[model samples]
Target chain A: MTELDRVIHEPARLRIVALLAGVEEADFLWLLRESALTKGNLSSHVARLEEAGYVAVEKSFRGKIPLTLLRLTDAGRSAFGGYKRAMKAVLGKG
Target chain B: MATDAQLRDLEQRPQRYWNADGIPELVMGLVWIIWGVALLVGEALPPGRGQQGYWMVMPAILVLSGFGANWLIKRLKERLTYPRAGFVTYREPGRSARLLSAGVAILTAATLAFLIVTGRQGGTEQSAAPAIGLILSLAFLVAALRQRAPHYLALAGVALMLGLAFGALRLGWDAINWMLVLLGAAAALLGAWRLARFRRCNPPSVEHHP
Candidate 1:
């Protein structure tokens, strides 16, 4: 059995990563809404993912309002894909 | 942990997000209405070089209107939608996919235009109106299925009914022109209503500085 990627194995982070995989890039608020995570909780998880080289974060302004944008890095996508395959294998559905 | 199926469903979120505020529908509705009106205006013109000139300029006007609609939708979404719902950009299609789409669109448009023109000139039974209806209905049906929006189903029905009604009337160019105008009006109103409801339900989420 292939070991799962620990960074994305956490429930909250898994949801966050799943949301990011759907779009090219999304703002902080977008991720927060979709993932149903508290603002602070999402921020912390995103920061951890950034440290893991799984997600890329870019800070920019939409006019005067500061926005934090996020996307799954290439490594993150591959990790998520692997995670899915592993789950499928475990479930006897692969 | 979500099963693999749920994760696949989550991947469709962006498409739903894009359709949430009805901006795309509104834009498409406006395009149909504008084109219908332009056709009527061209018909009303007295025959001369001016009429010929209007026909030539009509395509340019439609192209410009398309660009205008694109700009308006983006501006509106940025201010009205993103602040409330959230902001996400979808991936663009690959070059080959885009080229294929463009080719098909051109071919389809050319064929439809040719049929309508020749049918009118030959004074044949006006079958083009029903064809237009069928095409528009299919488009709305696709939207209904993809966006999970019930209103689009009504739109599909309206288009089909209008097309059949016009075809039955066999009133030549006038029937088709009127059908286009009515369909456009219905779509625009529906889109506007959906947008208003979306705005009412979702007050822009208070921006929390992360």
Candidate 2:
């Protein structure tokens, strides 16, 4: 059985990364809504993932509006994939 | 620990959100209507300089319609959907989905060709009628299932009924052409209605992203 990465084991971050896995990139607001996380909660979880190099954040402007874009880095994708396999392995035994 | 299906469902949420507005339906409906009209025009032209030339036009029309539909969807989404919902880029469909689409296209084309060729021996309208209904309804049914929109199933039922009526009446060679036009128009109308409803419910965002 593969070991799960600590960065993605937390439920909130897990949900965030799982949602991001479906798309190429999503704006910050989109992630917040989809994750059903409060603005502050989402921000901190995103920050923690960012610190671990599991998520990449780009702050930019779309016209005058400040836009924050989010996507999983390659490392993040690998970690998520590993996490999924480990969980599946455990589930199969159970 | 969340199961794979749970995570997969979570992954699918963003895609479902993007599609909730039914912008793709509007694009698809318009494309169908335009293509139907172009085919009708081809059938109308007399066989000679214009008709021979029109064969060339059919390919061009198909190509142009593809480009136009692609552009229209992006423009419509940017203006109507993106702001209200925020931005998400869906993953391109995987190989199996692409293969399924291609298979459907080929099957439809083959079936239509068979019907037309066989009908030419008797009557074009009579033979093609049931196939038209089957094809149209199936197309709509697939759309309904994929989009999880029940209205498409209703549309499919309508298409099926119209096809049977057309076959029973045997309205002649041009009957299927008119049916196609009606199908296109009906699709466009339904899509527009859905789009209007979507707009009414979800106003544009007032907040800038953090």
Candidate 3:
């Protein structure tokens, strides 16, 4: 049996990755709104994902306000893809 | 763990993000309105250099309206949506999306070319507006079905109905011109309605970087 990717198996990280996968890049605010996570919790999960090389983070300012952009890395996309396949195989239903 | 259906839903969510602001509809409305007015004005003008310049306005409207709408939408989102929902730069659609778009474009061109040739060969004067409009309406219908957006589907239905009416009635230039103007007005009104509702639902919140 192909084991699930531990990095993507966590529900919160999975949700975050899933959202990022759908778009080119999403800013911190967008993620925050979509994920409905508190600042601290979302940051920790994002930091962990970044550390694992699954997501890239860029910080900049939109005018005076700071904006943080997030995108799924190639590694991240591959990991997510692999995780999905593993899940599907485990479930044995398409 | 989310169910398979739930996962599928998540995957498809980004599409709903595209017209969240209703700005695209407003832009399209403006374009059609201008095109209709140009056609009407062209009808009255004498056949000369002046008429030629008048017809040229259609292309100018298309290009300018397209670019201007994009710029306006971006600015509006920056002010309205960004503060409330937060900012998101959506990922470009993948290869399949691009291929599908290209296919649609080619099909549309082919259909138009066929219409023009057949009409001319048959020695029948066929108005380009109704034919083109029907094709576009069908295209919108297909898109709405794919996206599963009810509002878009409704618009598609209206367009389809109008296109059929135009063809069946063998409408003249004047009738077509008025129809275009009405269509544009309807689109703009619908957009405004959606925009107001969207604003009510999504109130801007203080930036929280989480």
Compare the candidates by TM-score and give the number of the best one.
Answer: 1
Range of the 10 consecutive residues with the lowest summed lDDT in candidate 1 chain B: B120-129
Error of 3 at A63 (Å): 2.0
Which ranges in model 2 have alpha carbons more than 4 Å from their true place? B93-107, B122-125
DockQ head-to-head 1 vs 3, winner: 1
Full candidate order by DockQ, most accurate first: 1, 2, 3
Q: Return whichever of 1 and 3 wins on TM-score.
A: 1
- Whichever of 1 and 2 has more lDDT, that candidate is 1
For model 1, how does the per-residue alpha-carbon lDDT over B98-140 read when each residue is reduced to its tens digit?
Answer: 9998998899889877887788688764877788889889988
Candidate 3, superposed: residue stretches over 4 Å from native: B93-100, B120-137, B164-169, B173-176
Model 2 residue pairs with clashes: none
Pick the lDDT winner. Answer: 1
Sort by lDDT, best first: what order? Answer: 1, 2, 3
lDDT per residue as tens, model 1, A58-94: 9988777788889999999999999998888878888
B1-210, model 2: which lDDT tens digit per residue?
677778988887875775577677667777877777778888888889989988887878888888888888888887888787778877789999999989988987797777777788766557576777887899788877775667788779878987888888887656687677777677777878888898898788877454
| TM value for model 2 | 0.88
Q: DockQ of candidates 1 onward, in order?
A: 0.73, 0.69, 0.66
